[model samples]
Target: MAASTSQHALVSAKSLCAGPSFETRTSKVGFVSVRRCCLGARKLGLVCASNSQSSVMEPAQLPLSPQSGSTPKKSSESALILIRHGESLWNEKNLFTGCVDVPLTPKGVDEAIEAGKRICNIPVDVIYTSSLIRAQMTAMLAMMQHRRKKVPIVVHSESEQSHRWSKIYSEETKKQSIPVITAWQLNERMYGELQGLNKQETADRFGKEQVHEWRRSYDIPPPNGESLEMCAERAVAYFKDQIVPQLVAGKHVMIAAHGNSLRSIIMHLDKLTSQEVISLELSTGIPMLYIFKEGKFIRRGSPAGPSEAGVYAYTRSLAQYRQKLDNMFQ
Candidate 1:
């Protein structure tokens, strides 16, 4: 992690806010709302608290398997929490949201809160967010709900380097902190020419089917942007090389990024085909949890589904847009 040049500020904030931190009281309201359904057991409480502390303090380590054919050693005790960012400005504008770098709208903020409300239970130790503000905001809000604590998340140098989040977490109650990592591989799909264009207008100019293909196809890149396949190549490479190993070490991981970056990962995790992968939709702000044992991904909670009401609300919530994606399936 790169040290902040303001030796005065970083060092000062570090002193004032640092310690074995706990979630602030305000954050607890949402936490109680979501996890109240399952906290009855004393054993569960101990596991929850212990997982939180251990995941926060320890260095995650996992190695390659010793099988005849080499492969990464699979995680025995890992759970992955994948979250798409809350709705963004472009999402509400009925525009091609590819790589526009927009922040969330006011309603989007509520969606983020609702999202946090939804995933407040799992012991999420580290959060990985895209450098983009919308995703960053989503991660912060979700963590607050998850822990009910307001630990200041300072972006470390390496986190900034990869457009991924990484660094330390200091406890308000203890003298310890944990690090978060960020990477550009988590960035939204980069749309070249169609980035900010109105989806409807683009459809009219180019045949609607062609436009649909651009948005939902795995191999076809729109004028200047990357195809889903391109994004997957980069995203999965990072996941395999950097992120998966962490999960394999029995760590709980939180990934808050854009639609396509996440879809790229989903494609790898679920082993969907190129054609099939394009039809996948990750609802904004919803946390999709997957438990991994051995080398295989274990699905827990919900399967992939259509964008929720909140997601399309950002994308203008148009009937045609909804219908278009509906018809794109295999």
Candidate 2:
């Protein structure tokens, strides 16, 4: 199949809180309410947790055999996988975690491990992540299950000395390593004054309607923070300027970041309208795949497993490329 002709499919299904007081108990109630609201939104599919839309293209059964005398086509396209970081401390605490750096909770850690297992068979040549520790941690943990079993090294190009010191001398080792690039542009939408606030409390104080508008609306930002639109401006721009080139060069890429930032990127990839983007929820630790071919992105959805028919729909060239890498490790 021509790379451009293949449709993207998202597969796989089945994918927190806080707080305060007039003095004490009020905060706890507020936190519980906030947690319930977030959970309720997910249950109602109001949040962009996972793409529920089915692909028009059906998945072909695996163990694909080459036709006699037919050469497999080399793919000029590459795979792009996007994963939101696992739950953070604030995520579990039901706090308005916009842009506040926090580590993942234990559940979040397990989520990353599962995410890694899901994508282990898919080739990942490069990685992009936000500057936050949660995002960075998720990327590393997920990579732990990669079948390639290569070390993911952070690329330190900030300073001449740092670059020189971080350089790998062995070409063989470099071939087995994936370079991870971190950028603030990929950070979550800054929640502004709401960063550390409990969600339900904020809603109680600011009105549920107002909080909804700030969180779901494309343009309106919370006090002192970036709106989804503002976040898309930088996140999508960075994807185009930095990440897209890598994909164009036929490098399979994986991106680990925050929800809103990934949503902003998805808004661009899926050509979703502002209103449409509001309902596009992404589940934590789930990997959504896209094929960058002929200058367009084809969504392949989330793969249910490594051997799932749609997960690693490689072109002849891609299969060969993977074989070459595997042989190196052998």
Candidate 3:
């Protein structure tokens, strides 16, 4: 998203919301915590949190520790199950994937299948995926393996839940078309000017320093794409608006998105700095979970480590992208 003062306000206004997006004005409304509201990264246990208030000039607060998953909720606070998409065509080709729409590769399909195997048993309350098909397809396949047909749509009616949960603390069944919800807000980092360029070509033509700046700068956009800060602003806004409510209501959520988009959320939820964020790189099809408890932030999964690179060389083995991956393995 292009930078706007309103985007800044969303973070600093300390607003409250029922949807993932919140409206702001001069009113000093209750604040929501982003970090404390996420699910935990513990082996299999869930993390949950209650709502918290926010004053102006603060990033939203996160939830504290609680145990929960994807069952219909009778209480507040929820959990999260976050996964990146499988290997994309551009990914397999070793290309820069700023905003170019692409699909999962054969390897990508395998990764998504593995992801399904990873969380086949977890009760996913609601599914939030990016508008991109790669993310969406990966999510759909992953869920289809474990979750029942169609994604679960969240019905945020305190009144409705009050009546439905009278007998049991479970989410009442609603007649939603699909359980999955798509929001452009959750799309991958928009690589403005960098789309369709070969990473090696860009590195050679523009030099490594310039490419690094374009890729990692917090405030600088690529030739036509968004800066990390800008992406963070938009992604954060969406998370606050459409998703945080479910987390607060104690929904066990699953977010299947891209590298940079997830990075923005992780940056805020984990209190990562510009330096740390620049160093961070996400792997395909891996699940990175975050836990919240009692309306406060508790750290869960970090960005995945670099494994099998020197040994298995998942990126380098491919013939078309081999040289490029060889040059950039570190």
Error of 3 at 125 (Å): 1.0
114-223: candidate 1 lDDT, tens digit per residue: 77765554545467777788888888776666433434243344423432334333334222232455567778888889988999999999999999988988889999
lDDT of 2 by residue, 1-330 (tens): 111111111111011111110011111110110110111111111111111110110112010112112232236667888899998999999998988899999999998888887677678878889999999999999999887788888876566677667667677777778878788989999989988999999999989999999888999989999899999999987876667655655668999998899888877776667876776666788777666665666654454544433323344444576577578666
The per-residue C-alpha lDDT of model 1 at residue 311 equals 20
> What digit string (tens of lDDT, one per residue) describes model 3 on residues 119-215?
5534466677887889987887777666333343322223545334432222333322234656677787788767878888999999999998998
Local distance difference test scores for all models: 0.56, 0.67, 0.57
> Candidate 3 at 260: error in angstroms?
0.4
Residue 171 deviation, candidate 1, in Å? Answer: 7.9
| Number of backbone collisions per candidate | 30, 18, 40
**Model 1 alpha-carbon miss at residue 113, Å:** 1.3
Candidate 2 stretches with Cα past 4 Å from truth are 1-75, 307-330
Task: Return the TM-score for each candidate structure.
Answer: 0.65, 0.74, 0.62
- Residue 109's lDDT within candidate 3 is 91
lDDT of 2: 0.67
* Higher-ranked by lDDT: 2 or 3: 2
